[model samples]
Target: MPEATADRTVRIRLVDRTGRQVTDAEVTWDRLIRMRAEEHLPGHTARLAAVSGAGSATRP
Candidate 1:
């Protein structure tokens, strides 16, 4: 059987105070979306599980 994998591609733009690129640091859209979801969402465990695909969204 072949293993399953989820697509984790994310594109984002980041700049410093001078509007210059920061080396060794790349912002990901998925991470930012997950952070915002965690901050505004109510339930803690549910939200975390949803983001990490462990509880309900997990692949069987």
Candidate 2:
């Protein structure tokens, strides 16, 4: 879940890598959209790399 912040952006709480402290990170609407796509891109790319197609495939 996300909390609405005063900055007009949705804020999500994240724990530090060390797992000691918590922090608030603000994500704008545009960034949230990009983030959603970006989050899946790597997994999609990995799957594509692992799968060899019978036909030719070209990357942009």
Candidate 3:
């Protein structure tokens, strides 16, 4: 990134299945990206499952 764009904050939090505030853990970009991608798979599947084709839009 450019020097001017150095100011950035990636706030992240972890939690269990129950509503509990889990904290104080370390993570990396690769791990975070993979986790996020896996999370979106189910969401995307449900959103586009009823579409007619692969190029269909799930949202208006």
Candidate 4:
């Protein structure tokens, strides 16, 4: 049997105060681009969302 390669597709979502996804960034390296486009990876946007806390009682 032949070995199967894994699919690489990265999904990153950047949400503002209103939970809107703002995905925008630069890729200077080819590896990064490939990884992002074919590795199912998550960049800073995903990281930020993961660390962000829920909205507070007070409004900005």
Candidate 5:
């Protein structure tokens, strides 16, 4: 049997203090795009999100 690959889709949500969805900073946006495109691994995605202050990455 072939080995199965993990799903790389990560849902990222950014909201301001007013509870309104907002765009991420350049750094965060770059990371987000890369993550969403599956360019980064799950661990890397979570770390990037934390460092960029974008949000948390959870497994579902």
Candidate 6:
């Protein structure tokens, strides 16, 4: 039987005060993107989302 490969995806939500979605800083964005799209890190995807002072998490 052929080997099977599995992929993992991570999603995060960031929140700010007053219940409003906010954008991440450039540095943070780069880090998050790298974690998801690294050459050595295959079969995995990472996504980041910012919410109103509340963070969300996703598991794969």
For candidate 6, what is the TM-score? 0.23
Q: Is candidate 1 or candidate 3 better by TM-score?
A: 3
TM-score top scorer: 2
TM-scores for every predicted model: 0.28, 0.36, 0.34, 0.23, 0.26, 0.23
Q: In terms of TM-score, how similar is model 1 to the real structure? A: 0.28
lDDT of each: 0.55, 0.62, 0.59, 0.51, 0.57, 0.43
For model 6, the stretches where C-alpha displacement exceeds 4 angstroms are 1-27, 39-41, 44-60
Q: What is candidate 1's lDDT per residue for 1-60, written digit by digit as tens?
A: 112211344455655669897544434555556655775455666767778888554377
lDDT of 4 at 59: 32
- Residue-by-residue lDDT tens digits, candidate 6, 1-60: 112212333345545557676643333444556655773245322222232222545532
Per-residue lDDT of candidate 4, residues 1-60 (tens digit): 112223333344556668877665543344445666665355555666556742534536
lDDT for each residue of candidate 3 in 10-50, tens digit (9 for 90 to 100): 45686655968675455555555656778756666866765
TM-score of 2: 0.36
Q: Clashing residue pairs in candidate 4, if any?
A: 8-38, 8-39, 8-40, 9-39, 9-40, 10-40, 10-41
RMSD of each: 13.5, 7.7, 7.5, 10.4, 13.5, 14.7
* True-structure Cα RMSD, model 2: 7.7
Best by lDDT: 2
TM-score of 3: 0.34
Cα lDDT of candidate 4 equals 0.51
Give the candidates in order of TM-score, highest first: 2, 3, 1, 5, 6, 4
